[model samples]
Target: MDVIERAVSVLMHDGLVVYPTETVYGLGADAFSDEAIQKVYEAKKRPLSMPISIAVSDFEMLCAVAHVRPGMEAFIQAFLPGPVTVILPARNSVPEILTGGTGLIGIRIPSHDLALRLIERFDAPITATSANIHGLKDPQTPDECTVSRELLIDGGRLSGIPSTVVDLVERRIVRRGAEADKVEQFLSTL
Candidate 1:
C-alpha cells in the first residue's frame, strides 16, 4: 500500500503515526477517537490538562469539528495551509480531552504535501501535536522524533519551529513561533 494508505490503516486500528510538517514532526491519531487521542497523550507523556491541536485537510473539514465564526473564516483562509494554528470554539462532538476542558480547540491546515494528503485521504481530522515527548525539543527529522508511533513518514528535515498559535476570539497570539510577525500583522487588521 501507499504511504498515506498505510498511515490511515494504522490510524484505523487506533495506532499512532509520526508525520512531517513544514514546522516539525507531528504525532497523528484519529481525532474523533478517544482511544486514539489517549494514546497520543500517553506517547507524548503530556499532561491531560494541556490541549492538543487537530489537523484538517480543507475548509470543510475544518468546519466539521469547529464552530468557525463569521469573520474567522477570513483569518483562517489567510494563515492556514501554513505554519499557523487558530483557536476556535469546538463542536459538541469534539471530545473534552482534546480541548482540555476549555471548550475551544486549536486547529491547523498544514501546507506540507504529505501531511495534507495523509489527512485528506484519512477522510477525517487527526491529532496535530508535535512528535516529541512533552517538554522536549521539536523534532525536525525522523531521528529527532521520540514519540511512539506505528508509522513514520520521513519527509527529511523540517524548519524545527512550532506553528504560531492565534486566538481570534480574544484577538491575541498565544505562542510566538514560525511566522509570528506575519500572524501578528494579520491579526492587526482584525
Candidate 2:
C-alpha cells in the first residue's frame, strides 16, 4: 500500500503515527475520535487542557470543524498549505476535549505533499502537534522525533521550526515560531 493508504489504516484503527510536514514531525490521529485523540495527548504526556491543532487538506474541511469568522476565508486562501496555524471558533463538530473546554480550535494545512495526501484520504481533521513531550525542543528531523514514538514517516528532513500560531478567535498571535511575519500579517487584519 502507499503511504496515504497506510496512514489512513493506522489512523482508522485508532493508532498514533509520527509523520513529517513542512514544520516538524507530528503525532497524528483522527481528530473526531475521542479515544484516538486522547492517545495523542497521552503519548506526548501533554495536558488535557493544552489542546492540539487540527490539520486538514482543504478549506471546506477546515470550515467543517471551525466557524469561519469574518475575514477568515481570505487569510486561509492565502496562507494555507503553508506553515501557519489559524485558531478559530470551534464548531459543534469538534469535541469539547479537543478544545480544552474552550470554544476554539487551531487548524492548519501544512505545505507538505505526503501529509496533505494523508489528510485528503482521511477526509477528516487530524490532531497535529510537534512530536515531542511537553517542555522539550521541537524535533528537526525524523531521527530526532520523540523517542517514545514507535512509527515514524520519514519525509527526508524537516525545517526544524513549527508553524506560527495565530489565534483567530482572539485575533492575536499566540506563539511565534516559523513564519512569524507571515502569520503576523494575517492576524493584523483582526
Candidate 3:
C-alpha cells in the first residue's frame, strides 16, 4: 500500500504513527479516538495535562474540530497551510483529553505534502505532537524519534523548528518557534 494509506490504516486501528511535518516529525493518531490519543501520550511519555495539537488537511477540517470565529478567517487564510499553530475554542466534539480539559485546541495545517496527504486520506484530524519525549529535542527525521509507533512515514529531514503557537482567544502567542514575528504581524492587522 502507499505510505499515506498505510498511515491511515494504522491510525484507524488506534495505532500510533510517526510522520514528517514541515517543522518536525509528528507522532500522529486519530484525534477523535480517545484510545488512539492516549497511546500517543504513552508513546511520547507526554504528560496527560499537556494537551496535544491536531493537524488538519485544510481549514474545513480545522473547523470541524474547533469553533473557528468569523473574523479569524483572514488570519487562517494568511498563516495556515504553513508553520503556525492557532489555538481556538474547542467544539464539544473534541475530546477533553486532547484539550487537557482546557476546552481549547491547537490546530495546524502543515506545509509538508506527506503530512497533508496523510490527514486527507485519514479523513480527519490527527494528533500532531512532536515524536519525542516531552522535554527532549523535536525529531526532524524518523530515526530521531524516540517513541515507538506502529508505522513510520519518513519524509527525510524536517525544519526542526516547530510552528509558532498563537492563542486566538487570548490574542497572544502561547509559544514562539518558527515565524513568530510573521504570525504576530498578521494578527496585528486583524
lDDT of each: 0.94, 0.84, 0.91
Clash list (residue pairs), candidate 2: none
**Candidate 3, after superposition: displacement of residue 182 in Å?**
0.7
Considering only N, C-alpha and C atoms within 3 Å, which residue pairs clash in candidate 1? none
* Model 3, residue 55: C-alpha shift (Å): 0.6
Residue 79 local lDDT, model 2: 83
lDDT of 3 at 115: 92
Stretches of candidate 2 off by over 4 Å are 147-150
Clashing pairs in 3: none
Clashes of 2: 0
Q: Please give the ranking of all candidate structures by TM-score, highest first, separated by commas.
A: 1, 3, 2
TM-score of 2: 0.94
lDDT by residue for model 2 (1-190), tens:
8767888889898888788899888888989999998888888898998888899998889988889977778887888888889889999989888889888889999889988988889888888888888778888787777746435688987888888888876777888888798778756765
User: What is the overall TM-score of model 3 with all chains considered together?
Assistant: 0.97
